[model samples]
Target: MHRTQYLNSVNDFIDWFASNLGHASLFAHSYIDRRSNPAAPRTLAFTTLFDACKQYHWKHNGAFGSPAGACLQTNDAALSALRQALQSAINTVNDSKTLTASSAVMSWGGVRAGNVRWLTANSKGLAQTIASVCAALDSDNLSHPVLTSCQPLRFNAGMTKVYSLLVNDFIIYDSRVAAALGWIVVKYCQARKLPAVPRDLAFPWAPAKEAANARLPKNRDPGLGNYHFPRLISGELHAVWNLKAGWILAEVLARASHNPFRNSSTVPALRQLEAALFMVGYDLPLNVSPSGVNSEPESYAEGDWTECYTAARGKLFHYRVEEGGIRLLDGRFYPVAVINRMLIILVELFGTDPFPLANSATKVRVTPSIPGIGYAYFQATDERGNPPSASALAAVLHELGVLNYTPDNRAPWALDFGDYVQRGRIDLEALLKLESERHDDVGELIA
Candidate 1:
């Protein structure tokens, strides 16, 4: 796509998605509301959404499934695992006196898996590089060659993580986003009759021989060597391209926010812009799933049994059977009969009788019972009995609907619960009272 067209498409999609934000039930509206809140910490907001994207991808693409096509035992189960992984990552950097610096290093270290120890060993040097690059980016000094200082840490993915963690100024650079930028830049150059930036610069994994030949020294280009484009030149080019892309995206979103046809109350957040670019880069489906219902089955049975839960009216209504087909309670037939047929085949293929139960001793279990529907529970707990840090706790509370949140037009609740928790606030009796009240409410509904 042309640069203008690409920008327009991304902006248009962001507008459309923003207007229909509530459709993705799993991405609670509170998360979106927090993203636009200036008071919310940027690192926490971005990381939460980033984590959500990973789960969203796994849920939709069957990424957690085994090679034999067996699905995850349950959506909640898979989400729990994802959350645990995130909490483990959070635990690694939770005590940093300077969260932004710690987050940048940890995020960089994460992408460079085998080099984490090395990265950690040279934390001071990595910190310097991150600080310099982030400073240069903020000042729009794309010509400063910031990546040159990042010597051993040359991977674009890690560098992008550093950039993303430092500020909301740059988009994460991956192969897909890189390709989208390349297409835009190439078209822009073509239209203007300017020299095209080399494609090998954008996609560094071009075959070694081809890359070598492309960078061969010429009489007109004496400083150039075979490895110049991939090693040095490409990094410089990427820095320039990233700056341009960021500005273009910001401009597009800014215009969209003010567009007369747009109906969203707030401008798109940087994370939302990144997500829009990601979708455009990967050519992902723009439409949110119909009603945000999880289509995956929770359980299945082989001989004379089947089990599953269907989401309806904001609740997961359960079903089970000891026969040929699922039997919905109260003679509640599936709205889509074809889906039921597909579930039978899925059940036969992936069913493992007696689904695994979560271990209760190690997890904080929250089970809520809906009237006339079955019980649903989720288990999570902080690592090492440590209270979650401010950001981590915010994410958890947001997920649990316990956080102070309001939609676009309303003022957010003013609460110092996070501060109180940090100060070792402990009201065991009050907590017990609250729990008792909650149980009483559930009991009333059940009765």
Candidate 2:
């Protein structure tokens, strides 16, 4: 893609998003009005839009049933309670009562409630610790106070609320937001044609090599393993990760501010950018089904079915079908019901024949020598009289190396039989005739 075109698209999207900010919240209000609204007390309008993006993501990913409201309610209650306790401790201190960490914990009625466990073991230092961090935060020196002073209560979940509420410049540095910033950093580097940044530098939330080893799939090393899966960062690294996250956010914002497309008068705030990057990194609506196509699987009655095919390397591969899914030769499993439906749709649209006759005898045979090209075909017998399972059909198509299914739905399926051209010129006329007969047979069966 052309860089200028991509940049234009990004700017256009940002403009559109900024214009629609009022739609994110329950009540329609301008960004300026919402920011100044004390009663509503909303975060930046971009944050609300980002939350909407996340909701769309969850719904598409089949996990939208989670209790989002309940989670928010609990967090709100905890933050409110903590603020009340902190105010009471401050009032007592003003009245000349000794405000020890233990006394503060007692003042809060105990550390067992809500997310107050960070003050349990370090109860003795709670009052001094928070005071020092707040002081450093006020002075714009968070590394020493927030990172080092707050030991058990690290920067992310522990001190984020305090800083974000008190400090005008502070932005939340939780795992999700950090991951999103990392993704943006990587993308920015790629767009600028810079050397790839270290994964650790980009994604601070990833576990260390030693910790990651245990979680990786068997027989896979760090280089070959899938790093897409999310892992929790250890507490030991939280301080460093938070520092790096903050730095990355600052750098990204600095770069974004320099963009000529950005309006200097109405440039997006760092928090708004943070929300946008979070949506980009996380499963948001844009990354989901942009098209109207429903890529998710439809219900299908499933049964046990097994099929075998030979790979390009001549190694035999087996697909064991169970329910709506299939287990590949490499032990990786995929749900093929949706894929099968899509394949059916494609065949219906293209008028191509679906392979593997439902009633054929169990055997593998090479197609009769065409004028130039020949192909291998697998014939499987089903005495149970059940139709070929979707997994079985998909497995056959995959073996042919001509069916392409992009799970993300970012692209449509493709069929490329060019490999046969290298062996010999394909007999297009005969192949077309055979396919025509098969399509007719399939059409008759459907009727």
Candidate 3:
């Protein structure tokens, strides 16, 4: 009933991990081998796994942490370049000069770092604050704060690269790192037979292309009882979990030190484990159902969108609102006619985001973006302004007669729903009177 002690849980998980080094559940890794077709999911030696990840994520590779990790692609050269740029920015801040006058906004990790606009309010004390946190991490204080300090003192993903230069053993806590960490923690809890993921072990993950890549499933989130792990990772909680992960990983290296590791001395201790997790977290296959049920995509809609949509007129359907999406017995799914995703969400909940069949996750598994921007109003944000948890939502097919996704493997599926949903052409106010009600789980609905 009580919370699990952080160190104790780490110790327990380390021992268990050492014992089950070859377990398929935790380490079933897949990678493309030049010698053969992409390797199938199976048990792999931890060292072999790490090497595969390193090669997969070479420098400048487009893949997120390609091969294994962002850290893996990095070398002394890359670090030095980023570090020099960071120091130049810091030196300007130290001199109390406006950052606009220095190379404070150079790009790193494919994002702008030390943006002058972001630091306008927090420019004061920034150099000292950064120095203070650097001192903590320099002395191996993982709890010095990274995420919460990302914007204030510039500790974002790109900035994390600079901190790694300043600190002895710091891991970059990007979206991939967070996703990989959360996945591992979830596996640890499940293996330990814990009813819920303890607050100590609850590392939050930011939903990204990684979720849709089949590496981290959107459904494999936290929530066992009173404890609920958020799908989105934010600032303070990000720092807390980041440090906890550092602590656990540090101890794991200590416990596993006796075990033989391939290219043992190539990377540092904590980074080795982080890279392996980073590798496994990318493209991780879904756990097979015990009954051998084929894994298939299901609708994201919350309610029974299948019944004759005339009855669906009053029923409310939501997007990931609850366990199976929320449903109100007498409510409307679409109040206003919007475009792109909301239009998709409306059609989705109305049981109309269908194709040749029904209840499929998406026509294409990749995420679709609204064309031409200007729809930021539909975007959701956390209290701490972290990225939205539903960032990687799958695209649903719409029956816009005039518009259709280009018939190709990588179609955008973008559409404008202006006057379409409400104009009775799509029959939005008329309960989809023009469209056929489709459902896979239950029989098709008849009007």
Best by TM-score: 3
Model 3 TM-score (2 dp) = 0.47
162 in model 2: Cα distance from truth in Å? 4.3
Off by over 4 Å in 2: 1-115, 142-156, 198-203, 206-237, 243-447
TM-score of predicted structure 1:
0.33
Q: Using Cα atoms with residue i matched to residue i, what is each candidate's TM-score against the true structure?
A: 0.33, 0.33, 0.47
The number of the candidate with the highest lDDT is 3
Evaluated at residue 291, the lDDT of candidate 3 is 61
Estimate the Cα RMSD of every predicted model relative to the unseen true structure: 22.4, 24.7, 16.9
- Tell me which residue pairs clash in candidate 3: 53-67, 53-68, 56-66, 56-67, 57-66, 57-67, 150-155, 215-284
| Model 2 lDDT tens row, 1-447 | 222332343453234333433333421111222112456654333334335232221110001121222232332333344455555564454322212222222212211111232333344545555565556554433344344544554444434544443344455454335545444443344444545444444444321111122221111111111122133343424534444444444444444423322342232345454444433332211111224442321111121122353322223444443334445655655443333333333443333322322222322122332110011112112122122233344434443333432232323233333322112233223322332222211110000
Candidate 1 local lDDT, 1-447, one digit each (tens)? 233544453453335433333333322211122112446533212232223333221111111231211122332233233334333433353322222233323322222221232233344444454455666677655445554465532434445544654444566554334433333333333434545344422322111111112221101110111111122123555555565566555554454433322332132354444543342233211112235532321111111111222111112233322122223443433222222222232233223221111223323223322111011011112222221112222221222122222222122212223211222332223322332222111110000
Residue-wise C-alpha lDDT for candidate 3, range 237-293, written one tens digit per residue: 444455566666666556663443335555565665665665554433333443655
Tell me the lDDT of candidate 3: 0.39
Which residues of candidate 3, in runs, are more than 4 Å off?
1-5, 18-26, 31-48, 61-76, 84-106, 113-125, 136-156, 209-228, 258-265, 286-447
Which residue window of length 10 is worst by lDDT in model 2? 438-447
